[model samples]
Target: MTDATRVSPFLGLPGAVEGEGPNAGAPAHYGALVAEQRPLERGGAVVDLGNLGVIRLRGADRLTWLDSLTSGLVRSLAPGESGETLLLDVQGRIEHAAAVLDDGESTWLVTEGTRADEFASWLDRMRFLLDVRVERADEIVAAVGVFGDRELGAAAPNGVPLVWHDEWASTRVGGVSYATTDAHPGRDWDLHVHLLERPALEALAERVRVGDVSAAGIDALEALRIAAWRPRLARDVDSRAIPHELDWTRSAVHLEKGCYRGQETVAKVHNLGRPPRRLVHLDLDGSLGALPAAGAVLHVAGDPDRAVVGQITSIGVHHENGPIALALVKRRLDPEAVLAADLDGEGITAAQTAIVSPEAGHAADVPRLPRLGRRSG
Candidate 1:
């Protein structure tokens, strides 16, 4: 076994290690921890998503203005209703991706923690002449995520939105005001519990009794996200990559919506056809050795030694599929092309994972050229 494969005492799971904490040097279960805690195998799992963004938009125009600016149809979100949405620039590149909930009095946007300030600033600029007030609620709110099949409680004013999504059995507990959204497995729900006190935060974490998926880690979550083909801000896309390249058109882009900042480019691309690149899944061929760093080149199928076809965005060992990765490949490459990557001097062959194919049923399509630039050669 490779030295990197050495198991640590902190996480009984194999190949675990401390990832980004005060205990950075400490050993912890990297992927196994996440898997054990995923809402699937076990009944529930808790993630301290305090690092994710929580933005509060209050004022009368909150609904109409937010719906006008973002990619989701948020004007329709009744109190308690929740949905995932994306904030895009004029070029159609994603600025931030969020799961939002409305509480009649206010709207809450929960996203990656790093995007809190940036999203707030962007939304603030778009609020010209509108009655909406945009503010980052990070200091006032604690974000936690829980996933399971169990039924939850009413979490909104008049119980309107919560009652609307009654089909899902998840709820928030505590005196703190907040918003709750129903979500799919591996698709975590954001609990923007109002942080009135420190003890309340600690108690909420304990009450939920979030069991760390002893096997799942950020790595595991990345693998699952890649398998599901979810795109993240900064990593999968930037000002350079359009939303379609990352397959975010489904939940992020509203084709029927009238107009917004990047609407022109988005509509042009949709009508003309062909996004710059296409997101693909990679089933990495290897043991539990190591993974390549982000942006590592993937060799093209027809010419592996010379031409590069794509780049890896995320990598990990999946609980069900073992070593795997997600990548953004040049569109010229065949959807079924055979590819391989260099992982620590070892040649790791990777088969294209099925993502956009129609057989998959929900696979997102590559937006046409007018919507995004031509694919990189």
Candidate 2:
């Protein structure tokens, strides 16, 4: 991949080839990690989530202030509770994704490491009269994630103090979903992350070394994420992305939340029943022996010479699904349309069997729009 480098707490591990993508610059995976994915899915794997950033927020008005600023209902979050939130631009384009957790004394915001500084800067600028404190704890805290079903303490190792459990694997409580499958595959994903302090970081890595804990790399984690049709900010978003397109309404959004940045577009699109594009999961032909990477072009295979219509957002080699990818396709493209993904210069056939249906917004049918620039008091 790219020669760019990042620090890894588990740098001493074997087969750690600093990865690319969400866990970019971190160990991709250990040998044959994919073969052990089922055990991971069942709850016994710990991963060095160095690619994720940890931020600590503290202040009397922290919860309420954040509730007024984001798409999550964090104002009333109790101790040890976790939820997710999004910060969108005025046009309803997703700008920041945050995994929020509370520990009574502080609120923890877990997000991509690459964007933590930017997110912290934005948070600093928004604290006019609010009693809030925002600070990046990347130096003091490290992140570890687990895959499978188990108690938070058991699933998360090293006695990590903060955790944000997976909510996107299903239509989490309070979330309204747009998925059409009879049984959503992600209903069993069971992913979660734990935050540990610097001193304890090596302790956990030692556990993996001594065989007390099993470690998977970012590659293994990504396979499951892509197979579940999960979206990631580093891989899935372009500057123009809106929550509706990724079916983010299923989580990381509050349909009934009070006005915040981008509420207008969030409301308009969900009610009007339209999104410019839709998220689709593609089963790519594996005969080429090479999988398409993100940004690979998707074409309508039945059309003359295969016309370009979309581009892959995420790609992976899932243990069960084999070679698969996620793409943002033009919303109106027929569900049954034959598809192909250009892997490098080689064109590979693809089939669309899973998607966030085009008619997703049908459930929210707001008949009238408020006058321009008017908001209710």
- Candidate maximizing lDDT: 2
Model 2: how far residue 152 lies from native, Å? 8.8
In model 2, the Cα lDDT at residue 268 comes to: 86
Please give the TM-score that candidate 1 achieves against the real structure.
0.73
The per-prediction CA RMSD against the true structure, in angstroms, equals 9.9, 4.9
Model 1 lDDT per residue over 255-361, tens place: 77757778777766655556666777788876646767767888854473548878887766667777767787776677767887776666677888544331221
The estimated TM-scores of all candidates read 0.73, 0.90
State each model's CA lDDT, in order.
0.57, 0.78
Positional deviation of residue 320's Cα in model 1 after best superposition, in angstroms: 1.1
Model 1 misplaced regions, further than 4 Å: 1-18, 21-31, 34-42, 149-198, 207-217, 301-305, 357-377
